[model samples]
Structures are given as C-alpha cells and as structure tokens.
Target: MSCKRLAIIGAGSSGLVTLKHALDRLPGWEIVCFEKGGDTVGCWGNPYPGFISTSTKFTTQFSCYRKWDCEADPASRAKREDFFRGAEYGHYLKDFSGAFGLEKNIRLHATVDRITKVEEGWKLWMGEGTEVFNHVIVCTGLAERPRKVKTHLPVLRSMDELPEGKGIVVVGGGESAADIAHRLAAPELGNRVYLSLKTGIRVSPRYHPIRGVPSDFLRNRLMLSIHRGLRNAIGQKFVEARIRHREKFERAFHANPEGHAKDEAINARRKQWDARLTAAAKDNLFNVFHTKSDEFLDDVAEGRISIIGPPKGDGFREFSEFDGEGIIEIEPDIVCPMIGYTSGLEDLTDGELRVRDFHLGCLHVRHADMFLVGFARPIIGNVPTISEMQAKLVISLIAGNLERPRDLKARHEQERERVEREFPLLNTEALLPVEMFPYCDQLASMLDILPTVRKVGLRRWWKIMRAPASTLHYLDDDYDADAVDSQRVHSPPLITGLLVLIKLIDLVYRRMRRRASSRGSVCPG
Candidate 1:
C-alpha cells in the first residue's frame, strides 16, 4: 500500500465501475483493486444455471454504459439479447474490466485478512504483509454473507448441491428461497420442496402474468404518485378494491386481473392456483407477503413445492422448533433458510441494527476518506445502478469536485431519524433496504449530478409522480463531468401544488370541526 493510492476492495459490478470512474476522474492518483475470487462478477460469478437479470437489464448496468437492450423480446426462451442469463452477465462484468483497463490494476486472489484504521490511512492486511492507502472504497457487496440459521442444520451455498431427490424445506421466503425452490422443482431434479415464510410480506412476480410484461418495466414511482392522488380524489369507496396496498406494492398481479389472458384454461388454473396462496397466507390471495416471486407461487400451485409457515394467525413459530436431537424437526432431508443480506458480515444478532456513520450519501461521516459501495440491499430493487451512483459520489468527494461542510449536523440528524424508523424492518449498518428511485435521486443530488429527466416539466412530472415503474425507467442518464450541475435540473413537480391545496382544505376542515365541538354543536358531515 502506498500514499495517494486508492484501495478498492472487491472486483464486483460496483467495485469495477468505481475503479473505472475513479481512474478517469483522478489521473494522477494510484490505485490497487483486490478481489478474493479469481473472477470479477461478484455474486453473479458463480450463480446457479439459468439465472438471469431479475429486473430489466437497464437497471443492472452502469449509467454511462448500460447498452443492454431493455425492450427485447420477453417471450423468447432462447435467451434473447435484452435480458441475460447469469453466465452472460458475469461475462459482461469481465468485459467491463477489460474495456476499462481495470484488469491490470486488479490483484486477484488477494484476500485482506482484516482492515483497521491507522494514522497513515486504512490498513488492509493479508497474513503478515500490510498495505495502507489514502482512501478506501469497500464494495464487498450486501449479500456477501448468507443469512445464518441459528441451529446446526445442514446449509449450502446453492440448492443444486442438495442431496438428489431428497425432501427439502427452504426457510425464510425471499428471492433466494424462490431460486432454490425453482431449481428443486425442475423436471430434472424432481425433489420435493417446501417453503417457510412470514405472512403479509409481498411476493412480486418477475413479469405481469396477464400483460406478459416484465415487472421491471412497470414499477414506476411516478405511477404510484399519480395513482395515489387520483385514487384519493376519486374517493376511497370507488378505488378501495383497486387501490389496495397489496396490489399497489405488486404491479404484476394488478395487471393480471384487469384483462383477458390468451389461454382461458391457463387463467382458470391460475385462479385455482392462487387459492392455495390465499389459503396458506390466510389473508386472501393478495394479502400475503408483498414481495414473492411468481415462479415460487407456480411451484406451490403445481404441488412441486409444499409450503410450511404460520399464516396471519397465532401458532406460527418464528422459524421452526429444533427437536431434542439437535436437528430441526422438519422432515426435509435438506433445510435451507432464505433469509436476509449483509455486507462482509459474520452474523446478525437476532434484532440488532447499528447506525452507520455516513454523510452526504455513502461517505464515512467520521472517516471521510473511506467510501462504501454496494453495502445496501436492493431488496426488490436495483443494485448495479445504485452502486454506480454511490461510486460517483465517492469519487467526486475524493477528487474535490464535490464540496460540503465537514460538520454535517443537519444530515446526521436526518440519518438518526431514518435509522430509528427503519430499524424495525432491517438491522444492519451498511445494508439499508431503501426504495430504488428515491435512493438514487438522493445520492445523485448529493453528487450534484441531477439528471434533467427528473425535472418538473409536464412530461417529467408525469413520469415521476404518476407512472407505475421499475427503477429501469431512470436509466440512460449521462453522468459525465459536464452532466453534474444543479442548474441543469428542473424545479419541483406539479404535485406539490396539488398537495398544498389538499393541505389547506384539510386544515380548514379541522378548524371547522374544532369550532363546532367547542360550541357544543355537531359538525356537518
């Protein structure tokens, strides 16, 4: 390690992108990037077969160079040019490393044994040798550590490693659980699968079952804003069924009930299939977890995967009771828990959330020289783009292109409030599960690279405040040096005006009701 040289830990998507951007921005600075694994794809490097981008390809690429065709033929099973399998995506990250000349700067197979803050800088050690760099960017990734199971039940990195044809119970429902269930249920494996999940969390489909559109294409925040305002204006009675929170959270299911499916028999079968979900979740078909994969539900319906969980009633054990023989009583020969995500963490204390000291988005609040990237869960969101945005901010801070006060009192106060609010849901310092668009926008604003696309023009406002969307909609924005100016960003949206009016009306009504009650007269309905 040398002075003025930047230390980049991990050659994943976030790490590689940060390295490329830093090199271009800081010509005179020295850099050394490290990867424990020999390859550069990070999580996608050794992903299971047939694994593809769960979201639109656009959402999974760096902003300046996301050339993947997002509008490709979704129906093609032959692996079209738009969405890609995991192997191809890994190759894409490798290409980025080569094209950006990052390979020469990277030292593969070098694992840092531990890191400590020293007087010179951050000290990263491998065995007896140690190196210190002026600045450190950690891209170890959110899911670097699989959520641990408390008991000593059998565990594995992938479900494919499960004993063939053995009964399996997958615990803690999430994308990982779905991945395992799908693999086990495939015709070749034919292993019985069971899923355990918490009720009331959402299970979103990759695509709209009826529209045949990928879920990524339709989860627009703008759509949510407009729908909310319109639904509020139209009265709750009229929109109650349509505007339910469950459907609102999951756009794919919303589209399914609105139109006709090409295959009538398939649709009927799907409804019959949905009944199982309603029964298992114990809260109607739509009331279960707000984020589940449709493929997982498909397995549940076809009986390929049996589900064991507590419904919306009493009697559901948090996970499962361990038997007296030091084994989980579940009969599955293999038991896997698809739990939470963390960054380079050993384990989580059942309910422990530490507030990380970070300011201006991803920079260390106290250790300003330290930058963190890819440390948050993109839970049902985007990681590549989010990581890229954070990368931009880190480089900007280091290069002196971004300026702010050293004491971030206001910002720190807000961070405290945010942690207090979000602690109930997730208990990790670096891996906050923020919604995609707002998170990106917040970071982009901090970096002073406000894309004009988010400005308050009628079109932009419509896109921002009124569209059902995935973060993919915000892709293709230029993040070059010329693009990083606040003047280029437009003012607030039209919804602000409507919100002001609504607030006034609400205030006036409250005053009238108070006055009537004070006078001992009933307020008019």
Candidate 2:
C-alpha cells in the first residue's frame, strides 16, 4: 500500500500512543506530530505542583511499554516527582518518540490553529499560515479549556484565585473537588480548606494484587456475572441499577452520616431516599455515603474553613464587595478553581459531526476516514485504553477492514440497526475512568486489533519477576523481545488456562448455591 501522510496534534500521552500505533500499523506512512509546547508532554504550559497520576502505571503505559518496573504496584499512586517531575514526563515522551524513530517526524513548538476539510482528506493550518497534512488527529487533550463554575458568588471569582492561609471553600463533589481540597489543605499552604459537595463521593479502596491479576479482576468478574444475570431477568433497567449500586458502594466508605439530617419533615423524606441508597450499598462489597455538603460545611463554619449558602441572584455580576456572607471575607491570593474539563469540539467541527444529545461530544462516524477518539468519559476504566481502541478503529476503517455496505441509504440503515442491536443505550453517558477501560477494550475487540505487547524471553521474564519494582526498566531489550512476541500471538496459554479455571470456579459456586436453594431450607439472601 502507498504511504499515507498523517499529522497528529498535541504530543501528550494520547498523541504519543497514537504515534506509536500509527508507526506500527503503517510503517511506510509519513507521520508528522505537531506539539505546541517545546517539550513532549506539554505539561510545561499548565504545570501543577504536587500533581500525581491517578491511574496505575500498568494501565497508564502504552501496550508496548510497561512502567511496572518503575513503581509497578497498582495500589501506590505515582506522585509528580516519582514519575519524573511534570517537566520530565515530556522527556519520557521525547524518549518514547525517539525509541520508535518518531523524533524526526515530530514538529515541536508548533501549534495547529485549525483543520479544514479538503477534497482528498484534510488540511491543518499552523502558525504563519503553513498548511500541512492529508490526515489529522487532534490529541490536544481534555484539559485544554477550564470548566466554568456556575455560581452567583461574587467573592469567589475562580477556585485558583482563592487566598492562601485563610478559610476557603470549594464547590463540586467529583475528583476535582478532592484534588482542590488536597491542594488547599497541603501543609505548606497552612490554610483551612472546605469542600462543599452537594452529595458525598465514593472513594475506592486501594489494593495491590499479589500476582499479575489486579484486585478488581476477581471483583469485577463476579460483578459482571451478576450483571449478566440481572440483565437477563430485568434488562437495561437492571444493568443501570447495578451500575448505580456499584458507584454507591464505592461512595459508602467515605460517607458521613451526620450530613443526612434535615430540619423539616418533608426533607426527612429526602433523607429516607438517602438511607435506602446507603442500605442498598451495604449489600455490596463496596462502601458508600449518605452525607450532605453541609457536613463539610460545618467543619469550615467552626474555624476549619468557611462554607456557606448560594450567592445571591443567578449567574455573575460586574463586581461586588467581599462581605462576610456565607463566604470568608479574607482576600485570597490565588484561587485554584479545580473545575473539570470538557471536549471543546464545537469550534473544531461543524454540525455535520452529529453529536447525539444523549451522548454529548461523541461524534457519529459519518465517514470512514474521520474518527473521534477519547470522546466519552468512562468511569470504570483508563483513558489510554479508550484512546488505543479509537486508534485501532480508525486504522481498520482506513485499511478497509470494516464490513460496510456500498449503497448509501442501505449503509445508513444498516449502521443504525447495528447500533440499536449492539449498543441499545448508545446515547447513555459514561462515568469517567471506570467506563474508560471497558470501552477501550470493546472498541479494540470490535476492530480485531489486539494490544501490542512487547515480547520477553524466559531469562528476561525471570529477571523482571526477581527485580524490585523501583529498579525495573521498561526499555530493556529482554522485556521488549517477549512483549513483541506476545503482541503477535493470541492470548497466552497461561492466561487462557487461568480464565478457564476462574470460569470453572464460578460455575461450581453457582451450582452449589442452586443446590442449596433447591433444598428449600431458605438459603441466605
């Protein structure tokens, strides 16, 4: 096949992974990666001090490269300095690019202004009106724009603008709120920080696996089996309930009971609902909460941090005084608004992209050549997995590997039918991180693209098994050889055997339970 010209924008984790995958799939293709930042990771522009990677190193790394040797423990979170300072991530990216012979293909210090569609493919416009590329992949990342906190509060302009060494309050209950609270409460800051969450959050119990399998592997397998049974009995509603239950279970551990109290009898009904949810979570292995934001609010109220009511009026005003109503009157030096980020695809693509109102930001694949990657946020999985899946799908489409009808109307109808049959809740939104891993795995399987595992010899595997996590090296030749072989072949025999054993155990457990129930002695629910 003739070499195709591909241009990748933003040299972050996603872009680097895409570059590596593209090189592997289309070795003859002319690939040019344009990164706005001088460094590869692009963390230089928006550097966050004391930032840590939320994802485990195993899941975070590209399929070919494993970070297991360097802090391989999935339970331990990687601090900014541990991986290499934020700046050093860029260097690792550079090294990754070089290792794959992609350094020469990358155009650093170059920003893509706009991408316009052409007759053949697309044209990317960079600085000084330089037009380039036949194909373009925008890997600019989710954190490109900051999400605005919609509150009428005059004192709180932005979270980042909050003063240090004074009482401060943060709104929102997601990871962003947790991160902001952690940052504000840091020992160095010496400031009282309060997080105003509408509802309490579910924190996962951190655990490290003794073997190759993650702790979630066994738990998720059981959950997935139960989910399948529920789906057969109650359909989509049951699946949704299970998903919600799983989330609540995770939240229960961090829940504060005091927050559930209400002043009025009608409010007590709301509290009942909260109690029901908490009880439901109790049945599961995970922990959850029935707490309100006011619990955290009270801590700030009592000299910890100032938590208060909603600001007067709706939306924003020109300016206002720092009156001590609900908010602390102290003048904040910096307000670190830890609001989340969204995909800013409105400016990039036209209405033709067709984003369903149900699933916002996800593009309907109109043309085989154009594809959207990292659109949906998965709650159960990792982001890299999603990106990898998207990349594989795109590659398949470009290679004409996907089964498609020639007739336009027939194809459209066929596509709709497929979506309805396969993904009935095609419009359903996904929670971040968790959904990420499964969605990526699903996408890759759909495209028949296996993960590119680096092959290692027996000696190398032995060495890696014996070596400590801190001393492990990913780029070692011994590891690479075996990983490469693993990528080419199907699932390893050992993995298949383990899977069979797990299934046998599950079957035996189910039969035993069935036999106990059939005895009519009233088996414990």
lDDT of each: 0.59, 0.45
**Candidate with best TM-score:** 1
For model 1, what is the C-alpha lDDT against the true structure?
Answer: 0.59
lDDT per residue, candidate 1, 134-188, as tens digits?
9888777776345665544466556346567877766665566667777778767
Tell me the alpha-carbon RMSD of every candidate: 8.1, 11.3
Model 1: residue 419 alpha-carbon error in angstroms: 3.7
Q: Which runs in model 1 stand beyond 4 Å of their true positions?
A: 1-3, 72-82, 144-153, 209-211, 224-292, 310-330, 345-355, 405-409, 452-525
Predicted candidate 2 versus true structure: per-residue lDDT over 1-525, tens digit per residue: 155788777777677777777777775678888888776765432356545444434444555555443332323332222233344445556667778777777788897766677776777766668554556666665552334555534334333443557655555444555455655665566786654433334333222112322222222222333322322333234323533453353254222122222444434443333333333333221111112121222223233443332223333221222222343243333333444555544455543333232121222334544545555554444455466556655655555566533454454455345434434422322212223433443454455432222444565543333332111123322135444333211123443455446556667766767788799753422
In model 2, how large is the Cα lDDT of residue 3?
57
Winning model by lDDT: 1
Q: Which TM-score value belongs to model 2?
A: 0.60
